[model samples]
Target: MRRIVRTLCSVIFILHGLSVGQVKTGADLLFEKYAHLVEGKRIGLVTNHSALLSNGKHLVDAISESRRARLVALFGPEHGVRGDAPAGKKIIDARDEKTGVPVYSLYGQINKPTPEMLKDVDVLLFDILDVGVRFYTFESTMSLAMEAAAEMGIPYIVLDRPNPIRGTWVEGFIRLDSLRSFVGLYPIPVAHGLTMGELATMINNEGWLKNGVRADLKVVKMEGWKRTMWFDETGVRWVKPSPNIAGLATAVVYPGTCFFEGTNVSEGRGTDRPFETIGAPFVAGEQLARELQSYGLPGVVFEPIKFTPRDIPGAASNPKHKSIECGGVFVKVVDRNVYEPVRTGIAMLSALKKLYPNDFQWRNSIDRLSGTPMVRLRIDAGEKPENIVAAWKVELAGFGKLREKYLLY
Candidate 1:
């Protein structure tokens, strides 16, 4: 009986704690209990537009109104695939106006998946929605489409979700393998709290794919996710997974004001509070909100705002101080269980480099969004953001013991 009414709706939300519609995703248990593992085959999916379900539909319209899998071709990542492309635009390969299918562009100029884009496919789903930062490029477009479905041997799967900032809070700094890139390619931690099916089983058991190939992977997990629930305590509705993560309180201060996108300010991208509105144009907003509210940081609070940046077409077209104005501060959180978004983004980059030391700049893309350069050479030697967050506590305790060997929940 639908697995005993989903195990009594997970034991009445673990003894009457029913927070919202009761979580279930992983494309809602892959059409409820792995629809015979993609029933007749030929899938492809690697989706976008926040891949929903639980009746709201859109897992590419339930695998193009499935009988049981046949969705051949359609990929997109980094906005596109009905997600309203904006951040760094560039997606092209069109078609899918409503299942005309054939839509490629793994964020343009190809980012993997090309054996003739998986020659009519067989199995390779993903399902997006991941603001669990680590330079959020949808987990590097899901580890380069699991190394192109392990070089087209197919069977990749992944549909899991919910790490919307709460997988038991692991924090920043650890990208160092010569600063990998594509935002960060691995050695984990810019808040790497797993859950894209435990980071694709820790990028396929830590070999970190490519030239170590693997992907026969499968991960349809999520059923009342819990590595400390958040995503509004899981009821699964907020859909804005990109185009400026506009909800879940700007995704819990986006891994710390997304390090003001490596600087030159305006991390609030073209207004309407993009990363909770930090600012620039030679800031002042009540003395930078009283110097980030005298750093008593803990679950946030900062105010003095100003705003301006325009061209909001499909959300921030020319961002970073586009039509100017700035002056910043708004951050507000108020206790997301002691909100430590990368220590409030390294104390707002050490209070904007100690109150604008001649208008702070630093932009070599902030060491690939701080995957290292020791957090921009220890914040340019002025250190102390708690000793640069205690020099990465023994590499986040050996990545919490190699992330407890690929946690599934």
Candidate 2:
């Protein structure tokens, strides 16, 4: 027991040391470490606009210009190749005017690459920034692509990226298999604390891929990254991973506030502050803000404000209750380490429901976002926020153990 405790302490100390050092992403080391894999081969990349090297060159242009490698095609996730499309918007198959490589839509009529899409490719590479939430579709896209590649006997490589939420915090309920949607494809926690590379290994090894598909997987890892280091700590520039996630501060609050989407409230959508603000036309902003303060949620503070959502394509294209006057609370993350996003979300949700029992409603969509119908059921059943959170402790603890086998850092 003493040995185990000491080992854990040493690992934590090493992780902290790494936060202060300059880190190089997986793509930065590609030419030096694994040029042999891509050199002279027709490669397919599953990536989006957020992917960037430490030196700030986009991977598509880098690989296209590389004399050693031939860029064959591109596969886009929920967003288009350039990541300009909005959520759930169908992306048309188009040509990359920059590289002239045919861009296939993995998020449209076809969710995975057909045999026709893979015939000319020797290996498929997946590299995208993940915000470390289960509902984010990029990880699902990566797993699906891996399955397709596995079935076709093609090699799949994940160019590891940092989990922008930092890898030290894992929270929320484990998803139920019956509730798997594109939003929640696997039975993982909402705030899963793993990098893309680590998640790829877990999904593949744990048989979470479609039909238990076994991937011929390889992960090219980052240098000097630790699970404890957040995106800002990594010394790499932050690119908006998606249209709504505008900054690292927004990403910090997303895991919890995102649940508002499954309800009648506007989750700061259509506003300049998506995910950081929660509002509804029925809310009393000042009173709600005071109530939130009474909860004394750690690592965050709430301010009552009013805003109207605008119709901006790709950002808040058609947000709930758009253009309606909404009295809401804006969240400011002061200290990420102590802010329990899932718990905060649950507490706020509970308070709102209590405050407006007749006005607040949970849509069926909550099951997919929350991972189970039980969370919503428990909340409506008049359970305390702490108890609702506590119900998942056993499973969350079990998942932490299961996740250990696949961690790279």
Candidate 3:
């Protein structure tokens, strides 16, 4: 019995060593190195399903087990604390099962942490997953949280996460001032390839926080993370941060196909496979695929497919959900590096417009999603995809400079 126990201990040590030798995430770095900063302080955590440890433990659970950092309260983003809520729904406060701590809902009636929410905590910690798209609600939620933290004079600590989409590449146009919405409150391109920590640093440095407001802000940087490494390379498990985004493939195509949300076409909601499947009632998938093949978008293939949308159980029934059904195309990506998601998406939109002018309609709300009227307006005016993209090069270059100052790793 003694010999068997010793062998088990030895195996455990080896596994521990292997985990330590792997690349450290921002959460790992914070727990291992900078946890002292929050020692003895009343910390409030704002996080969701993505706030995970290297070994698949939630940060809340890890903090509860730690000797340092007394976690007082929890906060949920758009998807609620447990991340089970559908998009655009209100989250309510609840007790965490493992820690039994109070979890407040920031995405409810108010978008920011109120004074009441901050009263019991000295430091506000933010750790959530981000897909590296500008219009994702997580970015907006972070911005709002930063503002509230600054207003309350509490320190904001962001446990960084990889940008899933990688940081080395920059694409798309900078949002024009006229198109700002809750979806896009800042002037970033459709795909701003910075990690959450880098984004926090950039926003703080860029004067997004009011000049007079004061808050201590710090980012726990990730070790062994490179700008070019995609999420698959990080050896981190992918959790579905939102209902639609299920896997790395969904994330890779999201920057482009997400634009379909602003159109009459289906962005593949109400189906087993979302974002990966796209279509509309009027779309001739085969014809569209043939046309797209001629454009040579690089590293991606459009396969014509048909799908019937089903209701998500327990999801709120609305007019949009009354027996939802959509038809369109499936995007099969061969090489992420060679694929230009934004440009390909643009071409798809343009081709659909030409093929079915009457059936294809850009929802009036498109300006808010794309961050400008240009994408829809240009397509409506019969401009080619290449020319429409060319118009934004100057603005994109300017935003690139601004994006550089805030990169943390």
Query: Which number leads on TM-score?
Result: 2
lDDT (CA) for every model shown? 0.84, 0.89, 0.81
Residue pairs with colliding backbones in model 3 are 279-328
Number of clashes found in candidate 3: 1
Cα deviation at 71, candidate 3, in Å, is 1.4
Instruction: Specify the highest-lDDT model's number.
Output: 2
lDDT of 3: 0.81
Candidate 3: minimum summed lDDT over ten consecutive residues — where? Answer: 313-322
- What TM-score do all the candidates reach, one by one? 0.35, 0.94, 0.91
Q: In candidate 1, residue 148 scores what lDDT?
A: 84
Sorted by lDDT (best first), the order is: 2, 1, 3
1 versus 2: better lDDT goes to: 2
Candidate 2 residue-wise lDDT, 88-196, digit = tens = 7988899898999999999988888989999999989998999999999998899899999999999999998888888888999999989988898888999999998
Off by over 4 Å in 2: 1-20
TM-score-wise, the better of 2 and 3 is: 2
